[model samples]
Target: MAASPAKKRILVGQSGGPTAAINSSLAGVVAGAREAGAETVGMRYGIQGYLAGRTVALGEALPDDDALALLRRTPSSWLGSCRFKLPALDAPEAEGFFADAFAKLEADGFDAVLYIGGNDSMDTIAKLGAWGARMGSPIRFIGVPKTIDDDLVGIDHTPGYGSAARFVATAVSEVARDADVYDLKSVTFVEIMGRDAGWLAGSACLAGPDLVLLPEVTLDEDALIERISVLLEHQNTVVVAMSEGVRGADGHLIAEKTVAAGTGVDEFGHLAQLSGPSRYLAGVAKARLGVKTRAVELSTLQRCASHCASEVDLDEAFELGRRGVSAALAGESVRMCTLTRTGDEPYAAEYGTVDVLEVANKVKPVPREWICADGMGVTDDFRRYVAPLAGTLPQQLKGL
Candidate 1:
């Protein structure tokens, strides 16, 4: 569809999880909107907040380049984020929420909506675009990728992943260095964020970890223990990296054992699978293996450590945001701007659009071939792929 003759007023929001480069995307969207001669408004806390009648004009909020520049470097979502999953459209009761969503757009005079988020966020864009089309509304919807999970399909990697992966790698390497300083043998378990994909967890290999557990591979307690035991004989310290979503032989989240009712779920029906893997494994190692253990959960630190944010990730995230605005202005709907890897050495990325439905709510787990045959670590092939993505920064930990 070609853009209409009339100028558009755009509404932008952030949804699902937060990331270090999320703000960079926001800056791009705002700048792109201004450059395209469109008025841009922001949902205070994403669409969920907008439905409650909360919003602000972006031009007034970020009136100058100085403010926009600050936002581009800021970590986390400046517009706030929500995981409020829009119910399936077929549900009769959902009509009211849908009605309100449409009302919000009409009331605010928004002709285009650009949503910055991850997999579930794309689902929201797909739904809203479909709803608008069915209602004969000309409102355009575009999704800008943002996630540390890096599970979204139709792209080489979602924005916010490279920087997070860098942080995780740095944390693993630094934590390992700290653990080894003690004379007594010990095992330090570090848990990273990944619901089902192991990209973040797998990056630990760059830091020289003894083992890397990805959600794509089940957590084999026996094998993990055996490997640690063998390593302890010669090494004073062993560091094991695992994804938070790694499951045990029984097929339950390793975090499940640490909680009575299972890690309570969030708005997306995802396990709030917090630091359980590290704590549980550390507990087990001490009780069964008779070795000192410490569980280190990098948790939010990995996502908010902007000091280590990858320049490559920030640049791509900003460009993706800008591309989303351009796509919507071109009258595109139900489409997402994606990053296609063009080169590895030069680390080039090109923006393209894809049908939102095709990639919505999809999970692209770390490839099995990328995992070592033993399933305890990543293969050399994985290193070759990720090495260039994480920018050149001193990987050295400042303290400890």
Candidate 2:
């Protein structure tokens, strides 16, 4: 379908959490829009910014050469970001708010909008697209994927997850090497990201099969302590990687146990949740068995280290952004730009569109069958599923 002949104008925004490869997607939007003769503008700080009338001309904010170069090197959301969840379309105020927003967009001459974000962000696109269609607004809405959580459904893996996983594998390997140097009896527990899914934690398996721990596996704390105890007994140094979301058979986050004991809450009305299993589990190891323990939390750095991005991930992110523009121009609405794996041996991906409703707010978890029965590691099948997504090793140093 060809886009209407009216002069092309676009608005792009970044929403949700920041990621290492987010800028690549942003760059893709700008460059592709330009090549397609669309005048592009950026909504500062996502939809919240757009609602508040904060924006900048993309050409003026980021000149062509600079934007393209920055896209490949930049980490985090370059246009800023927001976590605001729009009211559901059925809500009484929804219609009026969207009507006002779309009116503002039309007044500003924007015929298309691209939102770069994860799950919740996609939902925003879906709602706006639907509303635009119903009200006969000419604006087209598209979603560009970005998330370290890798939980977005209908996409093989979110862009930032690969870079974050690379960081995890690198950090764990370095920590393991450091622990090995200390002959004194000690246990080092490293916690990794994976709020609900074990993708990031599972990436530690790339460092080595021996150091892997995943959230999908229900842990045996007693057995874990015993295994560490045995390893300490012989080597005097032990290192283990655990997911922050890991749970024991009783169904409690190790961090939750610590918070319950009075670590208290933050301003967000939530407990000061740490990113890794290390701190809580380390306390358990020391108090119950008297072993000297240390915990390392690999938190935000995992998502902000563009210096360590996988080339494949970066390229795919940019391509997704470009395809998003093309799709929107062709009258595709309520769709998320996605990459589907076509092969694993010699990794290949094909760009496509998936209904935003299929992905919005839904999580894709690591398969239970991919986890080992003992609940401490991933099976070979898991390796096959993820290894292809990680793609071939890059020439850049790992874990930058």
Candidate 3:
């Protein structure tokens, strides 16, 4: 009797930053691969570790249903992560790097390599897929999108965004109430993450922040101060949700002063230090408006708050992971799994694939029409588009 085809083997890795639902995707990959009668291996720290021969067998690391269930709710990258950028397919350095990486994959009989990450990570998949094609290799490369930034193109929204949006909305809502409790005039500035896109900062609209500042709209410092001064006159507390990436009319980051001295850019050339936007705004508000000012930077908490994760986000994230395995098994390559929004009435989404090359190194900015004419708030259309994915916030008690 002819021997059955050998079990398919695939390697997976996580890269870029971690998110609350990133592991849910990892769990789905592991569970799906096992159920498909395939062997699964994980990179300890994404491609960086894989290049160094650091890997773990998923069958041994996660043995059963219980492990996967727990992983779905686990916050952060389960297999560690990295931000290593790969050399261009045509670059001289690429000759050796690709040769070594492909040699390793071929030696281990890997049918595919799946990467879970954001824009930068997708770029890696694009390069690998291109290299494999050039060398006539059979191994496939796939990207399962994950990012709180929600900046990736070709997808309705990314997996980690919903959970992070949930956290931002919940935290801002709670903080708004706390800021108002003292019966004193105050301005609370909340700084949220978003380097080139303001999707995360725009989420603050779900919590009813008085003002929302986004990177898409340049900040007019004088106008902002005047607005806050006006807001303080009418309310006990004025809460503003600001994106750390917001820039001035001169096209420079308002939080530039906060960047640590001598901290260079990353492999992707993104600034390494991104904080203090809220503090700078708060100080300005306090000095100009003469009101109590408080600055709160959500920092890493937004991406790591598993307890605040949205069920919609986690479910979709996991399914996308499984989809990656199926795609690889089907001989698909250089593709990134995507979520297409099918309906808005009750909120629905369907999984699909887009060329990784189309998605890599791309940023999807919040639509201009979604922002208010004054650029201080989001429109009803924006709310409708994001509300379902982020889930509903709990009703809070109102003090009479």
In order, what lDDT does every prediction score? 0.87, 0.81, 0.92
Clashing pairs in 2: 191-276
Please tell me which model should have the higher lDDT, number 2 or number 3. 3
- Which is the winner by lDDT between candidate 1 and candidate 2? 1
Candidate 2 residue spans exceeding 4 A from truth: 1-5, 209-211, 260-276, 388-400
Best by lDDT: 3
For every candidate in turn, the CA RMSD to the true structure comes to 2.8, 3.5, 1.2
Question: Tens digit of lDDT per residue, candidate 3, span 365-390?
Answer: 99999998877888998888878988
**Candidate 2 lDDT, 268-361, residue by residue in tens:** 2334565536787888889987878899888787888776678887888888888889998999888999988888778787899999988887
lDDT of 1 by residue, 1-400 (tens): 9876776798999987788899999999999988999888899888888888888889999998999989988998898988888888898777897888888688878889999999888989999998898899999999998899888999999889889988888888888888988799899999899877888888777787999998887777888898899998898898999898888888887877786564478887776655587898898899978989999988889887888788888888888999899999898999999988888777777789999999998998888999988889999888877777777647355343
In candidate 2, position 396 carries an lDDT of 39
Regarding lDDT, does 1 or 3 come out ahead?
A: 3
Per-candidate TM equals 0.95, 0.91, 0.98
